[model samples]
Target chain A: MTVTVRPVTAADEAQWRARWEKYNIFYKRTVPENVTANTWKRFLDDKVPSYAAVAVDDSKPDGDNIIGFVTFLPHMFTGSIEDQVYLGDLYVDDEARNGGAGRKLIEYVYDWARQHDIYSVYWHTQHFNHRAQLLYTKVADKTDFVQYGKMIKK
Target chain B: MTVTVRPVTAADEAQWRARWEKYNIFYKRTVPENVTANTWKRFLDDKVPSYAAVAVDDSKPDGDNIIGFVTFLPHMFTGSIEDQVYLGDLYVDDEARNGGAGRKLIEYVYDWARQHDIYSVYWHTQHFNHRAQLLYTKVADKTDFVQYGKMIKK
Candidate 1:
């Protein structure tokens, strides 16, 4: 089955939300409805500078149901000494899995970054996300940098 | 040689800039003057929900000159569902090295976190920042979350 990717639009919100909920569940967590709604709103909010891309199947007649999505934001990198794109999230539906949709989504961002003269695209995923890592390994080298967080006790 | 820690004020701008310049030099970088001014302005800008703490040496009779500073922003963790403090930047002057100024800055932030009922306080430093790591290791447990980044090529 041939898959096509497109920029996410307001018309795709319901499908995107369904896929996002499933994606969060895979991580063994659930985001509140309001948070999800806010996230979707932010996607369409140009003033926020956030963007999202979605993958779809063209073989079907409708040719526009989103099967996967990727979200990212513009960030300044002190280490790189320049501005770059920061990929925040990427997820593909189980049915659309292993069909290069994820890779296409990344390449779409890569093309976007190239047009804008961005230095690089960077993101972090959980250690258990082996499948996503397999796809990521093909595109970029993993760095030794680590993420750490601690809760401030009230 | 007793040192006092306190909130940074507009009056401390000159001393703060000197210390910040030294700090940036150690990193082999120089931030724009306007950025430094903007940062100081943020401290007194009540509309901004950010704060900074400074380490001072009042025993010198200069009425407490700035030696070190720590800036933090309040954040809410989605997964753990807790309110925490994200320590953005912490810097101490080289002249103040080993003078307990750095430790005092952290201690003040720790106390501030506690009073606010913040569940935790956290920050990240490069692997090569041994001195900062040394101070960090004293107050919080190091975490295993890894950070990864990629350049989006044009």
Candidate 2:
């Protein structure tokens, strides 16, 4: 099946959320409803830097076109004049894995970042996600950087 | 030495830049002059989300009070309603290492983020940065996440 990528639109909400929720479930996260609502709105708002794109199969019907989604945002980087983008969320439908959807989605962001003069597109992933890393290592370079964070207890 | 953290002002430019350059040097990076200029301007502009705070020694003379600096900015997070901050650049002067300046600088950002309702403050460090990790382990939790990036060639 041939897959194509494009910016997410308002009409894509239901399917997007369906997949977004499943994506969160895979990571064992329970995101509040408001954050999901805000994320959808920001993707459609030009003023907000956050954005999302979807990978769709050309052979699929309109309502069922989307098989994967990616969320990204450009932010200031001290090491470069041009902003760098963070590939925040990326997931493909379970049945659609290994069909090039994930890689296509990432290439879509790389193209978008380059068009905006962003010189770097970076992301972090769990060490145990060896499946995703297989595709990632082919499309990007894995850096020797580790993450540390202070999580505030509510 | 009693280290205190405060929002950086215009008067702190020289010292901030000196330490910023040194920070970059330690990572073996040569940031362009324009990026450095823009970074300084963003820190002072309330309109921009980017911010910097300096760690100072109360007993030192005015010009020399600055010991280290941390740059951070809040951005929307997909998993939460509240924004999260990225502690971008952090450095303490060579002679000032082990004086608690690094920890104090991080604590300052935590306070600022908490006051603004940001629930997470995260940063990345090179795998070889065991010195900073020593302090990091005390103040934050290290994650099993590794970084991946695709750098665009100009």
Candidate 3:
């Protein structure tokens, strides 16, 4: 099975959505269709300053069907001299697991970051997501950062 | 030598800026005047969803005001069902040290968080800021969370 990883385009929306649905199921969460549609629209909307990349299988000849996807946004810290890329989502189909598709998507992001002179890329995941952690450990340093939150009264 | 902490109001802008200037000076950085103004405006802007609290010394009946401040924004995490508050900044006058004004401001925020039924309150500080860390330790769990960043090319 030959897999190709490339930047996401409007043409790959349907295939990408199918894979995203499977990915969402693994987490046992259901994203509303409108939200998903809006996210997809953001991926293709250059004015939004967000980017997404996907892995596809070319052997099927169905215009390179997407099997995985990653999305990120650009931000600058208040006092930091450099800007950063924050990874929002990364998902690969189970069938394509360990086939280097996920790694390729990450590598592509790294390359994009390097080419654009981005200082670093960061994301968060649950402690139990071992597979994602395995891949992440290779590309970035895991920090001691934990998220904290409080609710506000209306 | 008495110090007080209170909720910020539009009338406190001038003194707030003075304290903010001192706050930034401690970090060896000068936040642009425009950024400070915008931040103050955001805190008081009803259309915007941000909150702020201030520390003041009432000893000087005239023009005796804000010595420190903290600001935060309300947000909901994707995986968490409850709303959370993200603390944006915390500052106290160096001269007001040992008066417990800093602690008072933090306690106010904690009470505010509780009133809103928020599960937790969180903020990030530089690794070397021991003074801030000391105060934080009294209120929240000091998790091993570390921040990492890569710069993006302009």
Candidate 4:
């Protein structure tokens, strides 16, 4: 009857991968299977800071009900004294868009940050992702700095 | 007489601080002492992914001859098969700018990434920081994505 947001388990890899593939497609990107496999493995690795949270439908079976997911990692910043949680990805199944999965996934990350004593939780989206920006505006303040970077190798 | 780029040691904190302060001043940004201390501590802790590499004039005494520094951390990216080295901060003393200290410091990070089997190395600079861009162009390819993020809380 209710949507649940929680840490992902190994059993949800297939659903997580599907959502990941959809998310990448939204950006016109495709991740190699090896990269996807590694990302999923990191999500379960205790030694790695990588994590994934998913929103699921309680009315459906476990893996099939995962409608949305978010990934985040803790990072150190010289600008602040506390660690920052960098929200790397957030996406909800197209069919689950308006049902609050996106918002719940982000809030889940906020609580995670609070529990870890992380002072800031931040993330970025493409300039053209206006739909996501609409939701982003409601949940967090749009920060000041525009980021720039170069890729050194493949 | 030559510039030596290597991982920072505890003895280099003062010289590192001096260069770090100058770097912040260049961007009109100031990091509190506690944050600086935390960053320095992370650089030395093997458990943390954060790191600092410095370029120094070895012919001169140890710390005082330090001319530049670069900070980087290995991070997970959902799109990658492997972790990437995120180069967060890099600065060369104004007097030492043209002596290739900055380039040496970046190359040092590249070698570090190679050793760790990181798939890529990347970083960003302010839109107005043309000087750094000049060097970046020489060593890496300009990527297409624009970064955006919100600072939740601090």
Candidate 4's C-alpha runs over 4 A off are: A1-3, A45-47, A57-63, A144-153, B27-30, B57-63
Error of 2 at B74 (Å): 0.9
Candidate 2 docking category? Answer: medium
lDDT of 1 at B100: 87
lDDT of residue A6 for candidate 1 = 77
Q: Please, what are the lDDT tens digits per residue for candidate 2 over residues A6-35?
A: 999999999999999999999898988988
TM-score of chain B of 1: 0.86
Off by over 4 Å in 2: none
- Retained native contacts per candidate, as fractions? 0.48, 0.80, 0.28, 0.45
lDDT of 1 by residue, B50-128 (tens): 7887888766646346778888765433233335566766787777788888778877888888887776787667766
TM-score of chain B of each: 0.86, 0.97, 0.86, 0.94
**Clashing residue pairs found in predicted model 4:** A124-B148
Q: Over the full model, what C-alpha lDDT does candidate 3 score relative to the true structure?
A: 0.69
**lDDT (10s digit) by residue, model 4, range A33-94:** 88888889999998988999999989898658999899999977766767788898999988
* TM-score, chain A, candidate 3: 0.88
Off by over 4 Å in 3: A1-3, A150-154, B1-154
| Backbone clash count for every predicted candidate, in the order shown | 20, 0, 16, 1
Give the TM-score of each candidate: 0.68, 0.97, 0.61, 0.85
Model 4: CAPRI class: acceptable
